[model samples]
Target: MAAAYEELDRDSFAALTLDRLARRSGVHVSTIRRRWRTVEGVVVELLAERSSMLPTPDTGDFRRDLTQLTQAIADFNNALRNRNVLQGLLAAAAHDPRVEEIVRAAFVRRIEEVTLIARQAVERGEIPEDTDPREVIAALAAPLYYRVLILRGSIDERLVHTTVETTYQATVAGVFVRKESREGNRKGDREG
Candidate 1:
């Protein structure tokens, strides 16, 4: 099925059929139909499968960790197959509630998995104790997605470097510190 997607243009996912997928995967059409029901369903599953391949770095240095994570994201988006899978699923999610739900769930899972990187940075005293891990990760990733999905551009080394550097600077400056933390800090400042 992935091969079939790779063989076509990025926007050709809509033309995909169960028969094509079955032939590509060497699975019976009945089995494919019973399992996935539709090409969108199969793509949703592929998104889940491929998105999970990103590795969370535990290099113990916050900057290094961010660099590694950003590079991993770059590598993932750099692949035509993975990018097509994401592009197809996201385009489908715009009109299909089921696809939207699955896509959202898949991203939420990835966020949760990568949040540990930020949490570890906190433990190492590299970031603020009250830093919101989710926000941190989101800040780090939003630009890459924008470049790929919005700009329809490819990931380059310069973007990766800027992403890591900016996110790291913002995080260290308490840009992603939780609202509660910000409020408390303000209160403490006033009292002092």
Candidate 2:
């Protein structure tokens, strides 16, 4: 069943109808129809498994944490290159609402994992407590997604590292400025 799903993923199940999948898997059309839910299930499982392999940082430094996180993402992209299964899912997601749901779930899981890492940084005092974990994760993710999906550019280690560093600095600076402004406002009110 796993092998059959893998084949379907590489060939893009979107391009293959249920009858075609049954023919390719040497199963009956009714079997394919009955197992349709399993196909999405298997893909989601695979995505979760891959996401679980992402590195978590205990370095107690925001820079090192960001570097490690970016490197993990780079490694993930490299690993995904050999797995044609994801490409098939991407193609299917273009047209199938069920596949899209699975894809979205996978993405949410990835973001949640990143958020946990960022929250750890907050606990360690590497970032301000007011910083939203979701924003930190998004900062790291947005550029990579844009380059990969929009520009169709390579997601290399250097690019990932640079994006993380740049975003971290900018975000931290913005936080500092906001904090200073709030302090100034409080002081002004006290004087008045």
Candidate 3:
């Protein structure tokens, strides 16, 4: 069903019904319903499975690991079919609340996975202990999204490196870390 969905554009995906999926997959609607509960359930699970496959690099060097992850995503987005599907989904998400939920949920899931890098970095003293992992993950991903979706620009080599370095610089400068949290960490260190 997920592979079936991948072959579709936004409209086609939105048009998919349990019967259509059942017919296409050779599974009965009752089976799909019993297993997935709803169309949204199947799609959301598909999105989760899709994102879970995204690389989570851990080289013990936060910068390198982040660079690898971002670069891998960029490279994936560089492919025409994948990019078209993503763009179509983004466009579809605008009007459909169900689609929007799936898109946002998938993003949050990816954020949760990627944020582990930022958390690990704290233990390594690469990022501040008070740094918000979500913020760091956003910084790493935002520029590529902007380039692809907004500017319609190339997700090129330089853009990839710059995104990684800029996120790293901002992180070390405590841009993603709350000021009060950083202060509290300092206080704890001093007291200890």
Which candidate's TM-score is highest?
Answer: 1
Error of 2 at 25 (Å): 9.2
Which ranges in model 1 have alpha carbons more than 4 Å from their true place?
1-11, 185-192
Tens-digit lDDT track for model 2 on 23-138?
67677877666655555555555566767767676677777777788777766654433234555567668878888888888877778777776678768776665556766777
Say which prediction, candidate 2 or candidate 3, comes out ahead on TM-score.
3
TM-score of each model, in listed order: 0.90, 0.69, 0.76
lDDT of 3 by residue, 1-192 (tens): 554464444344556578777877888889999998876667666656666778799999998998899888897777654565566667667867888888897898789888889989999998777788888899899999999899977699999989999999999998888655665645443212
- The whole-model C-alpha lDDT of candidate 2 against the native structure comes to 0.64
Q: After superposition, how far is residue 121 of candidate 1 from its true place, in Å?
A: 0.7
In candidate 3 the C-alpha lDDT for residue 166 amounts to 95
Model 3 pairs in collision:
none
Sort all candidates by TM-score, best to worst: 1, 3, 2
